[model samples]
Structure formats: structure tokens, C-alpha cells
Target chain A: MKLGRLNHVGVATPSIADSITLYRETMGAVAIGEPFDLPAQGVKVCFVDTPNAQIELIEPLGDASPIHGFLAKNPGGGQHHLCYEVPDINEAKAWFEAKGARVLGEPRIGAHGTMIFFVHPKDMGGVLTEIMETPKDGH
Target chain B: MKLGRLNHVGVATPSIADSITLYRETMGAVAIGEPFDLPAQGVKVCFVDTPNAQIELIEPLGDASPIHGFLAKNPGGGQHHLCYEVPDINEAKAWFEAKGARVLGEPRIGAHGTMIFFVHPKDMGGVLTEIMETPKDGH
Candidate 1:
């Protein structure tokens, strides 16, 4: 699957409020949109737009949230995954599987009403990577 | 400073060749670009293009490489930094400084001949962040 654009960089933070302060006051990232809660994903996400792409800071709401697990292991916030925007989720999954990369989950619906999937950390050289296909938003 | 499009994601790797294969074979990234050696930056970088942005696999060449020191502390590849394309480096640096973020270095020449500077991890909640301004290239 070909990449579209960098959709966002996902970060696991102890507190989204503090993270947003650093991203905005310190890094010059502006709040361009509203926050989204993915109940199924077990996290709340907020976006900060940079010049090139968006930075998504995620804080887990429950014990089931992956962010909670990540924070439990790493303590403070650390660099997480680099998400690549793809055009088609199925095509991307097929391409990744054909290449012997370990896929995390079957293509599923995600934030922004898009289809997304993840490549395991092992196949991606120890860094978690996500591929997303943006849905058409009526203008 | 506003971001442009994402230029690339920097993945710190112990073995560049291994990481490159994963990207090319598994992720469908094309190695259509040349390998760039940034001695001053202390690493050899290979650029692979995806549909939207690029993935840069960085390997430290010697003891002088910062990646080497980073690996010494954290071992295995980790997410390095999210570099945003900026229109003005000086302006961005000033903004960061005002916000109490430690600026790693003055805006200087960086890899791939761009003007770039880094923000200390202390301010970003443990993630290194960079801002870059690229000159118009003659094609």
C-alpha cells in the first residue's frame, strides 16, 4: 500500500493537558480541531497541527487502553508510532502481509471514521507503525 | 513557524540495512533516493519514499554519532523525533525559548542541507523534537 500523507504522530502522555501546553506554547503547534474519544480504542485524542503533519496526543481513559499500558511500562511520555496515511486499508494490509510483516489487527474502523490497521513492532524495527485510510468527508 | 508537509520520520536503528529491507520489502517503501552521509550529524541516512511522506532509517557510524549514545542508553531502535517543516527557524527557536523549552542548538545547517534545530527532551516530556527550514531546490 502506498502512503498518502502523514496523518499524525501518536504519543502516549501522562496528561493530555500538559502535553498540549508543551506542543502549543513550546513547540508552536496550534489547536486546529476538536478532541476525539475512541471508546473502543479506550483513549481520548487531541490533535495539534504543525506545519507538515498533525501530532495526536492520546491518554487512556481505562485500564484497557493501550496508552495506559505504554505509560505503565515507560513511565513518562515517549515517542510512539509514526502513522502513514494510506489510500486503501485492504490493499495496504495485503501488501504488508505479503512482505511478511506482522499485522496487528484486521482492518478496522478508527477515529475520523477511517479504516486503519497496525504493523507490529517487530516487523517495523521495534517501532509501532500504523496505516490509515481516510474516509471521504462531504464538503 | 508553521509546518509544511511531513518530510520524513526518523527511526533510530542499529542496523540500517536490516531496517531498510523491512521498509522496502514489507512496507512497500521504494528506495528511489540516494543514500546521504551526514558526517557532521554522525550518521548515514537512507531515504525511502512512501505515498505521503518518507521514512529515514538512521544508523550511527562511529562513537561520535548521537544515535550511538542514544542506543547506549535505550538500546534497540526507538522513535527519534518528529521534524516539522518550518518557514522560519529563528522565529520558531524564539518561540520555544520563550516557553522555557531548552533549545539544543542554534539554528544551523543540518542533514540534507536544511537549516534545523532541536528542542531538548526535557521540555517535550522526553521526546526530542526538531524544526527545519529547507531552501528551494533547483530541480
Candidate 2:
């Protein structure tokens, strides 16, 4: 289970528009992607590409969204999770389970249209972590 | 200001030894650096190098260390901060200041023996951020 390269850092936000401005004006970040809704995930997402990684800005889509609660606690929003790429999602899942780390769910399609699964925070120190399978060519 | 590559993500741990085992045995990590004391920072530090970035395990060295407070709040340890490299520390500081982001203090020698400073979490979307000047050749 070779830990892979970082795919992106998830940043929950009250409003992606306002957060985009913060990244652009304050952080000098360019190449911001258009926002798109992910109803399954119950959030709207956008990618702000940086030098070495992407900053994924996410805003709750509705009342049932998990991000809604995070936003309630932090109106301005904050870092949600760190995602690392894995070559094979199944192999990664098996490895974590064998090591007694709790895998939150079975593999599912993630934001990038790639297989992904979250590891339980309690088992992963305290930080919520996402493991994503790298997208294949021409996806 | 160009955001250089991500240097490391700081993880506050109650025990570096336990965290190291989690990474080594659970995550299949093999190249963790030896733990070292950073007396000035009041923390014991170790780097779990990954393909693209690093996981910095930081344990409070004494009660005087700020990490002790973080640990008190989160006994299980958690993500503390995200550190990014900057080409010029002074320029980055000035830019953040101009943008109304709070710079915690004057540049000081960081654990890596390079100039670094913390940005207030409130101003950084609730994530403590560290801006470090890349170390010169051979430190």
C-alpha cells in the first residue's frame, strides 16, 4: 500500500463564489474551474488548480448535505479532508481493513468520476481522509 | 505570490511512536525519517515522506508547546496545519498582510531551519497555514 500523491485538499465553503475570490485575490491562484453540482454528494464542487495540487471548494447543496452541518459550525467554512491517489481502490481498501483501519464505505464514483472511498477519521488519526483511484486516460 | 509545492501537512500527535507505527505498518509507508527534537519549536518531529509531499508528525515536547493545547482538545491527535513553500518569505508575508490575512509573527527559523511563519486560522478559512521559505542548499 504505497501512499500515493496528493490529489486535492477538500475545503468546505459557505459559498464557492466567495471562496474563489479568496483563493484568487489572496492566494494568487488562477485557473479556477467552473462550479458544478454533485447531487449524489449533496454539494457543489469546483477545483482551483495550484502549483502542485488542487484545492476542491465544496458548498452544501441542501439541508440534508453533511457539509451543511460543517458550515453551521464554521460559517466561513474550512478544510474538510485530504485526498490521496491510489492505483487500485480495492487493494487499498483491503490493505486498510487488514491493518484494522475502518473503511467507511465500499468504492463509489467520486468527484473526478473515479473510484473512491473514505477512511473513518477515528481510525485515521483525526483527519478525515479520502482515497481516490487515479482516473484513466481519456476518461 | 506563487504558492510553491506543498511542503508538508502537520499532524499533531499525542505520541510520535504510535503515529509512526500507523503509517509504517498500516499505510505501508517505508521511508519515515528518524524522529528528532526541535527544542525551539517545543516539539518532536518526524517526516513520513510520500511520493509528492510529507506527513509531519509533531508531538509536544513540553507543556510550554502550543501543540499541548491542540492535544488537550483532541486527545487522539489530528491534522494541525497545512504548510506550503514560498519562494520569498518576505514577499509572501507582505502579500498576505495586504490581503488582510493575519500573519502570526515575524519570520522565525522553522523546524526545517528555514524562515517560516504561521497565518491565523480565522483568516485562513479555519485552517492554520504555514508559509515557509524553501531551505537553501544543504540548509
Best by lDDT: 2
lDDT of 1 by residue, A8-39 (tens): 78888888888877766566565556667888
Indicate the DockQ of the complex predicted as candidate 2: 0.68
The number of the candidate with the highest TM-score is 2
**Clashing residue pairs, candidate 1?**
A3-B51, A3-B52, A4-B52, A51-B2, A51-B3, A51-B4, A52-B3, A52-B4
Error of 2 at A32 (Å): 1.9
Top candidate, metric DockQ: 2
Against the true structure, candidate 2 reaches a TM-score of: 0.94
Off by over 4 Å in 1: B1-5, B72-76
lDDT, candidate 2, equals 0.86
lDDT of 1 by residue, B1-139 (tens): 4445556678888888877767666666654466678887898887776655566778897678989876775466867876667677788788778778888977888665778888887688767777778556710
Model 1 residue A1 lDDT score: 53
lDDT of 2 by residue, A15-131 (tens): 899888887887777678999998888999999876677889999997789798878877878778889888899999998999888998799988999999999878888878899
TM-score of every candidate: 0.89, 0.94
lDDT, residue A62, model 1: 78
